[model samples]
Target: MANFPLNRRQLIGGMTAGALAPAVLRAHSRGSAGRAVVVGAGVFGVWTAKALMDAGLHVTLMDANGPANARASSAGESRMTRGAYGPDEIYTRMALASLSDWKALSVSAELPLFHAHGVLFFFHEEIDYFRQSLEVHHRLGLPTEELTPEQMAARYPMIDYDGVAVGLFEPEFGAIMARRSVQTLVAQMVLGGLDYRRGKASPLTMPRGPSPLGAVRLDDGSQIEGDIMVYALGPWMPQGFPDILDRKIVTSRQEVFFFAPPAGSDDFSPAKMPGWADFDAGGLHYGFPDLEARGAKICFDNHGPEVDPDTNPRQVTKEGLAEIIAYRDRRFPKLRGAPLLETRVCQYENSSNGDYLIDRHPGYTNVTMVGAGSGHGFKMGPEVGRLAARVALGEDLGEPRFTLATKGTTQARSVI
Candidate 1:
């Protein structure tokens, strides 16, 4: 793992040699053919479309509310890009691959989108998950450190680790600007001659023969045809294909809050504090340092009630705010009464068992349905998009965890 620096001018110099060349070569390969129509312009859809374009295909991207809109799950200030999966090595690898692409894109964009402040995990009782994760990290040669409670207290003295049993630090991981990165990818692709449109799209009809999906109907009574079609609709999966995904994937309401630190205090900034995750008995709470002075970001990981992404009000609740404030007060006494700077309400399109659903539509071989971010999918967007593109182009990833058949109807949430 490369510990990429956050300096805007040194972004390119921070990357490992030849880090960006493979992705660029893969994109411009002459292996894939025909036209591709992708629905949804979120991180997943955008990356999949980019992958298709790189594979030498004519690709058209459509979005209902534009890229990373307020309603989309990818719309947020920042998202953590860490490799801690509590023993799930597959996701850890996926996150690492995605991180490379993120770093490459970050340097190419106007601003360095990835902030390399590192990530800290504060564990509670039962250290089995942490131990197994440490083993995987060591085996993979990832730079990870096991810190004692005393070490954590010495390094991050601003936060009070009352009941924290141990800490795991990954110095190479940090945060990725969410909305900005997605929009940047879309713009870069569009500037490179990729077709991007703002419209609502749905399959014209279920494929009943060996022929591929003919076309998709748009909201304005228009239609877009393609030899390969991908539906990476984030939260809209259940609504778009209710008959198959209604029970397989679910949408949950999630609340995020940003608290303003004390004036003239750099204690909560990225330079001083790393992005941290607390595995307490109550629930998993994670947050980032004050990057771009947008306050300290915090959110609980427990999935909220199921919601309809289309009609659900994007508003934080009083109760949710109270809960986070209480946690903040306990963890960081200095921020006990910090003013609330901002709040965002989003949705998580979670698949059962917390794994992604990247597979071909059972009714149509030419169409691939990709989604089920399950809250932690944002950081894995680049790799997910690439896998979705491969599946759309008639190649199998051979990873059953991502196959539709492996997705249970009940939400077990085995993956973090």
Candidate 2:
């Protein structure tokens, strides 16, 4: 574990490198006598504050909404949780390491955070991606098994395997109760004595002092000051920090639909269903068990339109719903034409490189910027939170997990 505790000098240099406003320096000085302030009370923000508090730092978590607010992605009912990553070896390792932390937190919070129901990758024909995924899992010592179409149909009768060529199963894979996890984390933060504030944070003036002095100006012009700041504002970051707008992060709007399975298709129930991802279609097809009474959930992976995060997320169009229904009809005939119960639109703050950005601000050492979720960040939220906390504390990041592309190397293409 690389732990880099930020000293006064390093903090100043980091802030300068990121070209942050001078107020950032004054607000984050270690010499300041105050608690650490985490902006945005989403999963990342709350967990970051909790980590800091556990490390003996007084924490003040400020967010625009209350816990599990719909404005944040962390409010989703569930997120697919799996560890059989293909070429992304680093992410697989991070997930494995995070399991312990998640389990510990689940126990402490007395909440069921994970469901080890396994995951099934259904593919048509012998695809290279599937082969590569199986190879990678084997090479990484992960438990995985291949199934023939007959075997798959026998095991998962709900799946229409008429044209399916192969299936890959990872018994260790599962799903996470995302909203519950967020609630648990927030509860732990409160239990640990972290202060909570609800308000929008704008740039604020810093008090004149030699010590670190930062203030978050709220909507009412009231300022909340702190010794150090953690910028976990998620998609709202672009408005708060405009300097890095062009450097790569952008918000994309995605929608998920829930539908009632066809009558007699109880096999799709949570007790028997595992998460499924299909690449046989032109695009990625992913779905999760609907454990929150919202019906079986399904969505296209990385095929959403770009949008501004501040706008309402309820603009899902009739065309979008049609596309989803068509997908279900073609790939999952059982759920085809099922009654649509609900739809959820969420924003993904993506990086051009398709990897997470968990580092100190180039110009502001005292402030750490956490964004670029890249669509697949929810599963690793706790690990990313831990890493963000370590960065804020000035701890050295150990071996990099995923292959993070720098601005110089990343091309001007969509992350998907």
Candidate 3:
């Protein structure tokens, strides 16, 4: 799927009319009519609601957290939007489709949801992983260019490419404003007459003969019945659905730190400093341009200790800050002495296989499950939501890819 420009009117139509509080309530009430209950208002849930509304279904979106709260994973500032799948062609295809949907949704929501500043994968020497990434990009026909160390330094002078041998640059890959995207999707859902509810859903109460459908009991014993239920709950997967409790979906806490860019560095802005990932260190180290001008946001890919989403501390610790600082000093010499401005933690609801689990509940047809996005799932949330909606609508989703079922397994609880 190629990227298509969004229409101007659609872009303007995505803005919210009133205050966010009332608009969310109104959206929830308006969408409660026809009979679709989408649990979880994270990025996936919001987009799922929008997609359902577009398909003419009265969609009700539910989440345990309050509106636009940072409790969930989608509350982060930015998420990478890259189609260079690094040997996962299926994901690449999905990313291509997702890019198209993201553009359309962005226009409809009237927001600059995407920032196509591109991604630069750095390495000290040519390795098999780089070769695989290059092959995947070539196979997908994505616009990926190989750069020599000198070429990369010349083009992206901000990077410290002292010992770098080669770089892979994907011009179309960039970042997405995750929170804005979710809020915009919810706003558009409201504009399109979708309902947004704030609560946790209990097990479904249904008739005996047919598949389990209708009426999700809330935590407060209140029950809201709908024809279809879409479980887009992120890390709350095990909390909501007990059947998967025994499944291995480990929740881990990860932190990203923001640093003040060096003075007089023109390339520190989003337009000049693209998202970067270095695979040379045997651990994933990535960074994004800070939107607040505090500094470039950077973090390691290593998983933190398992945490319960409800009570675990979401604040970064001094030790975590030290690790990030050490990374800067070791690899990014130019940013060695940068001042740390802020740090925040986010949860990763990862599966055992490191793949997403988007499928109909094995025991129930009316209940659709979309979760365990693992760490890499956010980059593909829009498309995942679309696929989840399709499943909820009783449409054939074709073959599963980047999913747990692909390996003939129902769930792999923890990948990290």
Candidate 4:
């Protein structure tokens, strides 16, 4: 039998136990000074809610499946985080700021969510993106080293660096336990006085006309008015606002595999190995060093075909499995036929241009909608939340790329 991950019951129980603080589930207190309602409790929504609440707003956070829902793109076990966004230093700077936030939140929660195991970038030839990334890293004074093929071969024997021109290694950048971290943040905030509701909410409507922000229409026929509303629903944006997001946001299936290392072998252990990204001749592949003896995590970054979050089947295709195995054989020679530990089928919310969409709704000034993670937005969530909150309060983000005007129906992924 495949080594299964935590069942639904176990995950929920563990989350509840981990969240030791009492949270108010009530919504729309008439006496509250300022009220804000945020939909979708994934990474974006959770963090925005936390930021709003921290700013002394009585915030109501509603999600259909709560934080880290299995169907959500942010529901994965781990996500890689680094400061290199090709030559784009905006994201690199944002990443540095977000990393500080991640560490701070983890410290506050008493959970080791951000693991700084370092990230290794692999290249088989002259890859412009890799070169540009290195330039940005060097310019920012971030710690990075160019490893010769021979050096990489000696340091990481597991990688098949054949025909590789060079490898760039960024020290102290690593992966975060996505689900646990999301759960921990929202959980801790809930314990610290965040009002979290396990319910679905819609933003296209309002109960009163004074402010277009209006009231959120709940699935249960209840209305909760808020001074501001934020929709960070990820893949569900198309479902809720088909007219607006059907063309702007695209959701695609992403498959991941974890292969157990050879028995008792320390080769792939976190202490010895670093997380790797292979932008090689064949394709783009990435994997993390074994953590907690959970084997190396591997996945392809290509945005798979578009998919619907609610209806698409969440299982890996046999062809997909074969393609992944081929990478294993070429990359980690020792783990070619290792036991398949667990499988996860997740999705990515892609904006047309692959940049995060963080703008107020075109029609409703009081409502802000965010989506298009483009498979790499997890690490930026901390900063995104604070930015979205700022936008709702009429603060200029100074980021033209995140505006809705840049988002379109045509898909061309340029952001790395």
Candidate 5:
């Protein structure tokens, strides 16, 4: 394990970001402190709550299972952070911007929330996403080192590079402590005077008056009202605000498995191996370097069957389990029979296209809706939160692609 504790100088820099705040937070800081109610304690919700609180707003953050609940999409050990979005430079830059904020938050908290161990994408010749990513990375000046199969085998012998035709190593891309980071952010915000509540958010109840705003009713029969209400319920978005997100957002069941490495196997450690994604697989399957002798984390990223977040059984299906074992055997032959350490079934809020849905509810301007992480949105939490906070504060982010109108009923996935 590496110690990325904040140094004195880095602490000063991060502290200055607090005084000046980020551009998005600064925009809201100009106004008087407004009372806002934020539903959900996932990455997007926490970051949005923190941004609003930082901008001098009194925020009441509510969640069913507290911060980074096991049921939440953001509750995971490690999340990949990469700028290789194929042709989507929008997310590429937004990811970089979010990384800056993550580093700053790590400094402020003095904890290593992000690990820049780099990410390797291996692909076969027919994989068009590889070339598309290279074009975007090259245009954005993101550093990458191309590798041949032989080169990859010479470097990472653990990975079976049989079908790997082209390899790209992005040194700046890395992984973040997803669940820990979200919990830590929420704790810090609470300590910084945010009102953290524990309860599931019910539908918004509109007051019978000329006012455009409404109060968020909790499952506890408690009504929490605010000048602005942000519904960032992640997969629960479609369930809570059906009319707005009915066909626009879908929640899918995702499965992840951790395998015990070979006895005395330091080869799978982060120092030796970086995070890797094998596009050569039939679908997207990514891995994190072994973490502290626990296990090697591997998960398939292709959208799974649509599920209801509230009632669906959150367990890996036998078919999905067998498929992952087969994938592991094919991609990493050395860890074929490793003991299964753990299996986690998570719900991912996905859009028809993988782009996030961040826009105001057409009926209410003050109630900003944020979600549809689509599995790839966790790394950009800070930027997304900034945008959400701005919108909740009544600013037009002007991002048409993220608007609800752009989301469709058909599941023609494009952006990764």
Candidate 6:
């Protein structure tokens, strides 16, 4: 996940839970209903396919590398979940609703996927973001606490509050096991009779004007025709529609590191230390406590250099490792020389303005292009799927911000 500095203008500029309820019914019969073909089995695509299937449509989900693959953005150890978007209430609401669904999923799963460890935000000089988010949280009735530096230290003694001015703690917000959750959701959908295929799909032909597509070509030279099609290819969105999305949706490399805490110490556990984001010196540094015995995970929430997801080498740069190590030592004195246990390299498919692009292609009216996660998309998977399904079904659920018309050629991210 990527987080960037928000200026006053950026902070100023930048949903129903029942409507997103998952219908987990076994596929019995779809009498004359149309077939919906969804390409890319990432978080968004998987949920979109599920929503479409539940809408009484015969749905087919296709992916080249399978769900939660190593290269997929949705394939990660964990992701933070919080309803704080610095005044962006739409995302806040969606995240809140998504957390509800995630809790439900975890309750029914064999192993818990959602970890309710809570999340904290450390606000430094620029407190406008935190203040605005606090207002929204209060209005939404989210259980959040405004804590001073002294209170934060008293609450979380393991973390150093050197430059922190204040803190916002969200008790209900937490982390979700990324890879396992996505895989589990997809597997459950498959067990419920979702037509899943392992193959690469592309537009058979570039149809002119706003016309329905004929078929989507596969790597095996076969074509899958459907009444409606959805392309939620994440980083591959540019490759899928180079003429349009090549510049609109950019893919950037992101690095994450996990360090082993001290032995025989429970202070670094999720129960002792909640997931935290530091906004000191106008930078975003975030991490989670040791979860499921995985080392304390940390990542700098800034977009890295652009990279081709398919070809980029998934190696953490030496500078990145050193930087994270220094940050770890400064924030957690006990882990001054913690050994690195694991590392991951992922790509965030970002839109021009850090908002999602979910709308029908002008040329392919029946085909919906859903992507541009912009780093903070994982937690909104369920709602994104619900909105995508509604759009693919020809419903005019209007939201100007998410439309393709708002996308630009150059990136000027306003949403965090």
TM-score of each: 0.91, 0.83, 0.85, 0.89, 0.89, 0.92
TM-score of candidate 5 relative to the true fold: 0.89
lDDT of candidate model 6 versus the reference: 0.84
What is the TM-score ranking, best to worst? 6, 1, 4, 5, 3, 2
lDDT (Cα, tens digit) per residue for candidate 6, span 1-416:
11223332232221122232122111122335667889999989998998788777788999999998999999989999988899789898778656767888888899999988999999875477888998898776777898988999998998998988889998888999988998898889889889899999864345666577767788789988877889999899988987778699999999999989899999989888999999878469999999999999999988999989899789999999988888888988988888899999988999998999889888886788899999999999987887898778766566899998899989888898
Best by lDDT: 1
lDDT of 6 at 285: 91
Please identify model 3 stretches exceeding 4 Å from their true place: 1-34, 107-111, 203-210, 400-416
Write model 5 residue lDDT over 1-416, tens digit each, in one string.
12224332332112223332233244446664667889999999998888788766789999988788887899878888888887787887777667777777666776678777889988877467778778877765667788899998998899998777889898876788889899888888888899998887776533343344557877778788777888889988887876657878888888889999898778888888889988865877898988756599988887888888767687788998898899999889889998999888887788998889888777764678999999899999987887787777666666798898899988888987
lDDT of 4: 0.79
Estimate every model's Cα lDDT from 0 to 1.
Answer: 0.85, 0.69, 0.72, 0.79, 0.80, 0.84
Clashing residue pair totals per candidate (backbone < 3 A): 1, 21, 13, 0, 0, 0
How much RMSD separates candidate 5 from the native structure? 5.3
Model 4, span 1-416: residue lDDT tens: 11223232331111221211111112224444477889998998888888778666788888899798998989977888887678777777666657767777667766578778888887887678888988987776777889999999998887778778888898857888899888898878878878888888753632243346568888799988877888999998877776567778989998899999998789888778888888876678888988767778889888898888988688888988899998888778889888989888999899987889888777776788877788988998877887787777656667799998888899888887
- The worst-scoring run of ten residues by lDDT in candidate 5 lies at 8-17
Q: How accurate is candidate 1 locally (lDDT)?
A: 0.85
Per-residue lDDT over 198-223 for candidate 1, one digit per residue giving the tens place of the 0 to 100 score: 89985344456545566888767889
In model 2, what is the error at residue 35, expressed in angstroms? 2.7
Residue runs of model 6 more than 4 Å from their true location after superposition: 1-30, 203-206
Model 4 error, position 313 (Å) = 1.1
